[model samples]
Target chain A: MDILTISLVISAIHLGVPIILPMLGGLVSERSGVMNIGLEGMMLGGALAAVAVTFITGNPWLGLLGAIVSGLLSGLILAILTVTLRGNQVVASTAINLIGAGITAALVPIIWGVDGTSPSVPKIPSMTIPGLSDLPVVGPLFSSLTAMDYGTFVLAIVVWWVLFRTDAGLRIRAVGESAESADAAGIAVVRTRFIAVMTSGAFAALGGAYLSIVTLDVFQASMTQGRGYLALAALVFGKWRVWPALAACIVFGLADAFALRSQIVGIGIPHELLLALPYVLALVALATFVGRTSAPAGVGKPFVRA
Target chain B: MTSTQSPPRRSRLDNELRAQLAVPSRLSAGGRGGTGFGTFLASLGGTSRSVTAKIVSFAVTIAVALIAALPIVYLSGSNAQVALQALIGGSWGSPQAVAETFVQTIPLLITGLAVALAFHGGIFNIGVEGQLIIGALAAGIVGATQHLPGSLLLLASLASGMIAGALWALIPALLKAYRGVHEVVTTIMMNYIAINISTFAVTTGGPFAAKTQPSATEKVPLDAQLPVITPGTRLHAGLFIAIAVIVILMWVLYRTPAGFRLRLMGANPQAAAATGISLPRTMITAMLGSGAIAGLAGAVQVLGVYGRYFDGFSPGYGYSAIAVALLGALSPVGIAAAALFFGTLDAGAVQLQAVAGISREMVSVVSGLVVAFVAAQPAIFRLLHHLQRTVLAGRTARRAAAPVLPPPINGDNDLISAGLDNKEVL
Candidate 1:
């Protein structure tokens, strides 16, 4: 194919990876009977943590670790509120989102002595595959892939396998489908949910770190934007499965890439309208196909011990 | 826990579930033999036990939020005492400060009510921010272009705004009611779409863009602007409108048949459906009503404050409304109070920054803390209960064996159950 096609494909994958991480995170948490609308917040927390740690340590790998730790903490907060306290998952998640936004925005000035955007920090370098770099057309794409991008791809497979193949996966699905029955069957519902949610947080934070350290190397307040919500839409579009969700993320990423490139491509549509393409598409997709897919039966409900 | 009941008599099970869920005896668990007062407060739609508990919880929530900010402030190299002083002085120290606080309160009060209404009906209308934007855009376009008399133009502008907001909400409402799509996701999507649409309308070369200000529309006609209530302060007649809306909403929520249907539908969809209520219709109406109120908030901001629609005019007032509504326990009076408190925080932020060298984003942290505390109310209640039990037990051995009270009202159960029921509809 031509350079334009190859570049578009590469852009889509790069854009898709951020969303895929969160979607996978959400998938794990939801599969274990927890509803995490706070993925956006967790992702934001991760982004900030990554940036702050990298700024202090001058190491992108350490920044990635910081993001994961931040995400896990966010997940723990959600788990405590929703699981132990039996609070409304959605409300707790909303609170998490607000706190994520507020804390990140609040700390920006404190850390960098600046507001809105942080100073640029060191970013993760892209990896070059020796054999793939020699390919004719798509070599550039392979050469441009970062470690995080490859990690995300592998992570997706691990998530899918853990969710569907292993004994732990079965327990999660069982709890999600019927927490009461799962408890009766000797599974620890609350523990399973807590772990799932924390795992979700770590994954989501990794996604946020990708934006800061891997992609931009600078953190902006609310920079995750609505990618967290878009990931939710993608999850719904994918019917709460692994492969389909990943595909859905790719579709959204493609839409995002097109919107970005369309200005240069001189599409007749206004740039403002172009920016709205992904959300519009999400709305359409949700309205049309959401009726067919079923969420885990016990999702959203607090599992109160009898 | 009650799942073992026979399926043949589902209504009875629903009744029991409603009784257990609706009456928050646990809120009054701190007081021995306080079930009567708890039931009375619950009947009056209050989320806490007595007025005392409500006040105490409110104070604690604020205090905790402030204390939580202390460490952050210290870490930021700002003096906590100075920050506190500035926050107070800016929000309530002088008449001018009070007026400014009210300025912030107006939109929050309106949007908080909009959010509370949807929450009461078991719908999470997260798109209020988007609805407000669309409303403001409509009001701006109409107020600027209309050729009618002053009063007529103002009315038309406000009406157009409400219509725009309702129309915007219609998509999510229909999708939620008919397709079982969750409004949380759909409304959020609408918010992004609204932001984009507004940006397109006001940006340079767009339809409503001002020649001098590319990111904002032309000012509305003088006649269309809200009349100032105070001579020097920016306070306007929007305060009165906000109050009037609150009174009307309270009546609608507590005294009307439609309101009863809404509450019933929220409390238990099965029971509501059994009582001949149309679930989808009620959901659609509640969502539309929420959107209209949210729209009015935007219009009021345009006419009363800015006098024109500007890009990014709202600093997430819609999202903040959720915290306000929850903190207010979804009650109109409570929401008004909560909005006033949040308004104080917002108004004080500027002074906090000027005097204490702190960032205005500090207010967001406080608000976030408040919401987090509110979300964990059950745990707070339990902690209070445990403390009370220990103290009471120490005072008298006889009271030590008293059984645990029932759980506090899970305010979000209606939302979860409503979502579940909606999915089962199609």
Candidate 2:
């Protein structure tokens, strides 16, 4: 029981960080009606950039910031496509994903000064709350620290609040539901969409930062792997509402935890099958809600002034 | 907001854009003409388009794409001159590089053609990757274990790959048809499933795994492997087969009745069904044919290129094929050219690394830029329409007799979106 509990908690923390950061990213662009398929690439690019930057600067915080900036740049390109040019969101997103894969594979050598692997670096510092420190299993939450772990919880609630309670949120949703209506109502649809996409980049970058700083302390090609896809699935499974989306991400986190525990406990299951579980479950959940759930309606489509 | 308030001439450019870009969905069905082969021909060559017009339009598009590529290349390097030299040399510089370019393009062209076919038939076979991986594994295993004569073994590998690809697609096809589960999501999920399964069998438990590359399956027997088309280059016989397949596709698409049915279904399945076309049989066949073509792409990759199955040998060739098929405008001839073009880029990537000192990531950026350009074609078309209309208005005012402008494209209409142009090879 102790083994299962500890394994579950670790897996949740591991999978949760990747999912939550990307979820924040997805929430941004998706909320604004741009389908950010390039989240995978952004996460990946950020992951590699973080490791490389950390290795060079020997500063974990700088490395984390570098990852965020890289993601922002990727999101910026996406903004250029979906916002300025009003191109197909899905197409632009796919291109970005490909860019991430090819870019990371190529940069791995140049940044690391090695063919495949990079030098290991120091980790991000973790902190615990003063009074909450002596608590049981939850007290050690601050032990294996990365900067984004604390930020994720804060951002989730803040973003949810900013999305639902603020005037900016109203305008963003208006742009998503009907750009024409939004434009007539004096909302800057293009500007809002662009900001939303840029914010998405920052969030996805944080996900990458979590990996380089908190998760592994290094990077590899496509290392962000299909976690980006799972986050997207979380967005869909959540029906695009922020809190529900986070909840969906937690489920994926648990599934990831399940796989990790199976591995640690010698479950005798194949690694391939274990890795395949989250995706399979994602598909099942997605399929169950396939036609039932609707996206922002304008998602994957480019909006133009009439 | 201020732009809309400008003078008519300036705002008229906006008007021209707004005018040209109407919702095609708004076109009432009353005056709609039949979209059959007769319409296809009329739309292709019998309308307002002249050879000069076609040539000019295509040239302008290519020029714009290249011009857009300039900034990207410059940003990719500080030493632009060296980058250019390396880019050209590394990609087209050596015989081996050129061979590699063409070699890589073969499976893409074939798989792209398959995708084009199904998309044209209005079935989205997005599971091409899953199908491709399975096909490659099946044939690789067959080629490695079979003791048959060399020639027969080659034939068997190809068959097994095709069958495997076809079989992989069967479930999604059924789900889409009966369960009403959209093939897009189902196929994407299946791709993940298929990839994992293939990885598992080849690495740990698959019956035909090798001892040397214990992480992957065994290589095919030497005799069963594809012969080289070019004696000194990496280019293999797969190129010839891909070309032959393209020719076969063109003939079937334009000449055969079954081809007629596929096209008919593609244009409008409901209408085709109303006219007595068999929806189920036609749908199933189109899907199977698409699977087979994608399967062929896998067979060639394993037998002609890799000679063994490993994880991710494709490097997204199946997905790239989708872009190729669309860029080719879903024609067999077009797909071949697009495939070759993409092949050159993949080839140039190595050159970028070797000569320009630019990483492979920049090549991906270039590719994304190209696709971005392709997706932005409609917008570009609108821009061109504005330019042409303005120019024509000037010319006609001076002459007192200008020809009427061509109609603008409606973005809302689902007219041959190359994104959905999932044209693997239909």
Pick by DockQ: which candidate is best?
Answer: 1
Reference-based TM-score of each model? 0.90, 0.82
- What is the Cα-based lDDT of residue A265 in candidate 2? 71
Across residues B187-215, which tens digit of lDDT does each residue of candidate 1 receive? 99999999999999998888889999778
What lDDT score is found at residue B127 in candidate 2?
Answer: 80
Candidate 2's docking class is acceptable
The runs of at least 3 residues in candidate 1 whose Cα sits more than 4 Å from the true structure, single-residue gaps closed, are B1-48, B383-426
lDDT, candidates in the order shown: 0.83, 0.70
Candidate 2's residue-wise lDDT over B346-369, tens digit each?
777777766666665565555555
Fraction of the real A/B interface contacts present in each candidate?
A: 0.57, 0.48
Error of 2 at B127 (Å): 4.2
Candidate chain B TM-scores, in order: 0.83, 0.78
**Which 10-residue window in model 2 chain A sums to the lowest lDDT?**
A138-147
Model 1 per-residue lDDT tens digits across residues A79-143: 99888876667778898899899899888988888889999999999999999988999889889
